[model samples]
Target: MGAATPSAQGPRILGSRGSGSSPATGPEAPGSPLTASPGGRMGLPGAEILVGLVAGIDVNMPCLGFALVAKDLEAARDVLRVCERLGIELSEPFYTRKGLCVTAVVELPWYENPVHFLRRRVEGYLRYMLPDVRRVRRVWGRLVWKRVRLPAAEADVLMPLVERLLREYGMPGLKLPATVAEDLEELVYEWGRRWRRSYDWAFKVATGRIFRAVSRLSRRHVVLVKLEDLRGIKRKEKWVPVIRRWPWTRLLRLTLGCTPPWVGVALVNPRGTSSDCPACGGELKEHSYRELVCESCGRKWHRDAAGAANVAFAKPVEYLRFPASSPMNPKKPGGGEDGGNEETQRTSRLVDKDPQPRAPRDGSRPVAGVEHTRQRGPIEGLTLTRPQTLPPGFPASKG
Candidate 1:
């Protein structure tokens, strides 16, 4: 995290729900055309460029919260202002010293105490198997009781074969019963089926949320994920079962598998992602069950959103570096002994825009990205406008 302070202007509450019109209900519709190509465009010769926004994702049990922050500080802030003015998906965008951070939380319908659900399923299997096992044991015991009634020599011969059969096919430790192997197989199948259903459902929901977020924003180049390793955490014996069953690693795999080849996914450390404020690097105090407030700046934040924004701004601990000239990179490497690429020089640049839309010689004006012919709905009067360009000599600190 960077060392910075909150704006002296105080928290402006960029997208808070209010007593007036909904913050999502803007005068103009927030929809804008995504004009850049997926992955990125080729940069100037020998210049390494990050052609799109960096996406940071915070994966939690209740929801997957994500925030998009541009590599260029100024562009990120501008994007925040634009999205707020347009009211995109009723999302919350917060202004931070790093840049304008836009966040969205996708709710999940996954089972709480998922371990309990699996245990209940196992109990159901036991219920069905108990009667079968008891019946087989009783029948075997009755046969043994009749052995004494038979002629001595005949009983000896018959008892040996029956006992051998029981040893071969039954659970011998408790005077084994028949069909136990088949019963065990059925129990395992049931457990697997139940677990697989829950796992698949969660991944599906997460994939949909990721795609939806990407579609709404402009082009994105990289996704930073907070790596949550729950294995080493201490827990009670009862909780040990729950922690072992956690699907965080599988969810991380889903994030990796579902993204486009051009999108670089990296893992960042999870420590303090939610505890620290996104606006300032101050500790956050619990404000509510699901909210936290910065102790230093007094900024309130949703627990998950704050974590996601932190992931967006935090440095990645693990990432696959692409060759500067690769399609995924779209930049040329400079001739240097260290294989250094000049891409960092271009990191502060925004996605190139087409020359501002001009009116036709027919003497009529047209909105840049707005479609006037579309039927008016909730965003009927909304028009999309680009943010004003900053002066060349504008202080980088203010940006």
Candidate 2:
């Protein structure tokens, strides 16, 4: 795999928090009627746009966490309406492959702690999605090519030559003529820089406990959903993160900015749930963590894709629980938490316990050894093995 090139680099900004000014005030203020309502800011302007959905995927080494945010009731309804028309059942867990989609996957490196690893993974995912060289080229080419139709042979030749020139000279990659390159490069650079900063700020805000708590406080009516809850829809769930971070709504506004005759919904994994025989809800047996395997029906699914379909059809109310219950919460009132006595909470978070027993360095008999006889260890009979079946739609190469 290629090392991910730094799309754009600059000092990270953690949003308006440090500025002491609320994020609700700036010209591009998040809570503004014109700006998108992130984290459920109140009194959001009616979504004049037909469908606005925000999906977030928390990428993890083992499983991806995903959530969807629809700005208005109409947008959510539209999604449901489409599912109904397509003959997809929302109540049942299933995948829907529809539309241009993006997802995030939280990655846990072998050495890093889960929380830190997840934080970094989220930051990286957001940066990857922002405006970058590759995205610019792809979008630019499409726009330029659409207006001027040339003979197939001539058009192909010109495009390649232009690309080569840009590469050889270390010139900024733009489809326009050399005369316009200077201006376009500056614009591209500024746009990329701003977006990179915005992404960094947004990421910090999203992952922090403070932000999450504040979000809950601000939007009392909002229901937070997690990808794990949608596991029944798809057999595997790796790409749920990608689906969540995809800026579909932003892309819509950017691309179709004031156009009246624009209408489309892109689905990435369409065959996810519909093609499966609904009679066999037995397909559910396949869902373990992120893999969807139905032994009874002999059907398999990529967990993420299946979940995405289910997400498209499922009502927000059905999967409204948190992804992880807080382990820090006190089970007993007198005990502070973590099963420790009240004193433990006042002193420090650590729990005191008897020293762990050490294991014998080498196998030895209880007496003199002819051949080594092993004693029953704490985990003597238990074996740790890799998961037997891969989640559906997981690329074999990923394994």
TM-score of each: 0.48, 0.22
- Candidate 2 per-residue lDDT, tens place, 64-98, comes to 33334445554355445543454333332333232
Candidate 1 overall lDDT versus native: 0.51
Worst 10 residues of 2 by lDDT: 258-267
Model 1 scores worst on lDDT over the 10 consecutive residues at 39-48
Model 1 CA RMSD to the hidden true structure, in angstroms: 23.0
Candidate 2: where is the Cα deviation over 4 Å? 1-179, 203-327, 332-334, 337-344, 347-399
The whole-model lDDT of each prediction reads 0.51, 0.35
